[model samples]
Target: ARLFRSWKPQLALHAETSGKNAIVVTAAADLDGAVRDIVKSAFGHAGQKCSAASLAIVEASVYDDERFLERLADAVRSVRVGDSTDLDTTMGPLIAPASGNLLRAFTTLDDGESWLVEPNQIGDCLWTPGVKLGVQPNSWFHFAECFGPVLGLMRADDLEQAITLQNATLFGLTAGLQSLDPVEIARWTDRVEAGNLYVNRPITGAIVRRQPFGGWKRSVMGPAAKAGGPNYVLTMGRWTDSFPNCATSSTSEVDENAQFKEYATAWAEHFAVEHDPSGLAAESNVFRYVPLYRPVIVLVGEGANRDDVERCRLAAKVAGVTMIVSRDDEADLLERLLTIRPSKVRVLGTTSDAIYARCDELGIPVDDTPVTSVGRLELLHWTREQAVSETRHRYGNVRVRR
Candidate 1:
């Protein structure tokens, strides 16, 4: 209770695992590189990390190509799963004795699923990586977050089918697409909904800030201020203009809409920016905003001005999001949360700050960006942040295949 009253930051981090994977579009592309990257991304860390590539939706032609299959199997088989301290060990064992979703994946197969490379339990907590082919759409393996060293392979007639299969899960933390064709890469990246998108590279092991991590749909629980990104600590501190910048615009107009419009030009671009933070010639990193699947629920005080409500509506519109505005003398945010289950919750005016702490415990994200503030930070509350990383150069030379 004292901490709540104190002006201290409440930092949070969600470490729970989710189903994340990649789609290898092997059309007019580097087959050997794809196998190398897929094997590494899917089996790395024994598929224990949330961002590990648990599924691979390969284009039908590539899935059937013997060269691709033989190479993938060879790569999987060569991995030496043993003691983590061993220099020769490629990956470590499961965190504990596998149970639940992961155990089922290791021990059983769905109706239409069959093992391409069967798993061999080599230790109490270690099992040889397994790959399941013929993973039917919407099957148990398709959506389950089986946090183990098991990879599910699905055959897609075309890129469209591959993307559909990739997005069939509720989670969208990290997804990758492998293709040598720039046209296919552009088309797939534009449509794929994920927190992180990688092209021609391993999907796991994201670099800090450059690949700011968090996902939409059910992948994230809290406000998803990405771990190493600019907005990570935003909520924990209150906004203050003690040392004001003359260059920055100060929103002070009595008319909310007019004030918002004054800074409207900078709204979207300010909150998110696409840049190669690494400045690496071999890689391209794009950090952008992706709208959340659910609406943000905004609670306003009974005495809230009409202009304030209008500003909220305009902000959501500009951010390309929908919102539910609840104006009541006593806002029932908890009740509404039970009913609507919004992607996030924010309150403006006399609403008790205590609710924010409560929501945090429930794993429901809370947006503390000042409602009256305009420009830079508002959009972060309305949209999910995504970092798209692509390996543009192969072996330090310009990739010619794409």
Candidate 2:
């Protein structure tokens, strides 16, 4: 945050990884695609690349199946780590011995920490894949970004949990989700916090013009300038005669239809009492909540009672974000998740073991309290507050307002 605030170059771009990227494989995901993408993303380039998938979050459905884990391990082991010039070499060495040492230091877990793949050293620059299990949101395995062939593997109870774990990092460089189901793909795309998002393809190897890579949060700044894209030049400096005006215009043409215009006017008037000009858009801090931004929030669950669903809807209203998707029937949950392209999804109500197992993924901290007993609004507020407090504690005096 300090770097973001202090640095002001012609075009400022910052990329930092505490340790590694995380990958998620859903139960409905194609095993072939999962294996292929995981290997290519995790160990590709000797896992020394910035975009390497350092953590693999596999759904319990597959993780519980020892055979599948074995298959993944075998594929990882098959990767030949040696000299880049060697024809048989599948993985390459670190840039320097310091890099290897740094990788080892970042990956070395403390007592009681889960170790999915024991840290096995083959050479100073080359090492076997390191996998760590039971990674908490605050765990170094989940937060640190290591540059090496070492990868952490954790089993999530469901897809949502997997996604939650995947997104826990402050870094949002690249994230990959493997699932054959279209709904899962849509939901993952919407929820995962990464500048470069990959659905079946490998997370790394983004094409210059095609992918247009950039990061969010601590990962980057500016317009997420794509290296090979047409806008890549924009980062170099203004190509136009006048300094470019990049502010987004909220202005839109008023509707000409009489009925629509009248309806809009009436709607505005009906809620006039709730409107506040000095909250988000305005400068006064008198505590009026007229939110200028309304983010999309998705609610994924099954067996949600009427009250639980209503509470979630009410929370969305209070928060000024649209509740794009809500599911109580497990059968159609995935379909609903796919249809609604939500950016921030909240788990609401009591969901099936399988449903939670599949879609309740986020890398942020988890609140396992039942929705019926504890309202979704309460949970959301608590999580946000916790995050804010933690951020403030870590980087003192960082101003954050909701």
- Candidate 1, residue 396: lDDT: 62
Work out candidate 2's RMSD over C-alphas: 18.9
Q: Please, what are the lDDT tens digits per residue for candidate 2 over residues 6-83?
A: 332221333333335777888987786688788888778777777778877888889778777777777877878788
TM-score of 1: 0.82
Task: Give lDDT tens digits, candidate 1, residues 314-348.
Answer: 67877777889876434466766777877777666
Query: TM-scores for all candidates?
Result: 0.82, 0.56
Error of 1 at 263 (Å): 3.7
Model 2 scores what on Cα lDDT?
Answer: 0.53
The numbered model that scores best in TM-score is 1
- How well does candidate 2 score on lDDT at residue 98? 37
Each model's C-alpha lDDT? 0.74, 0.53
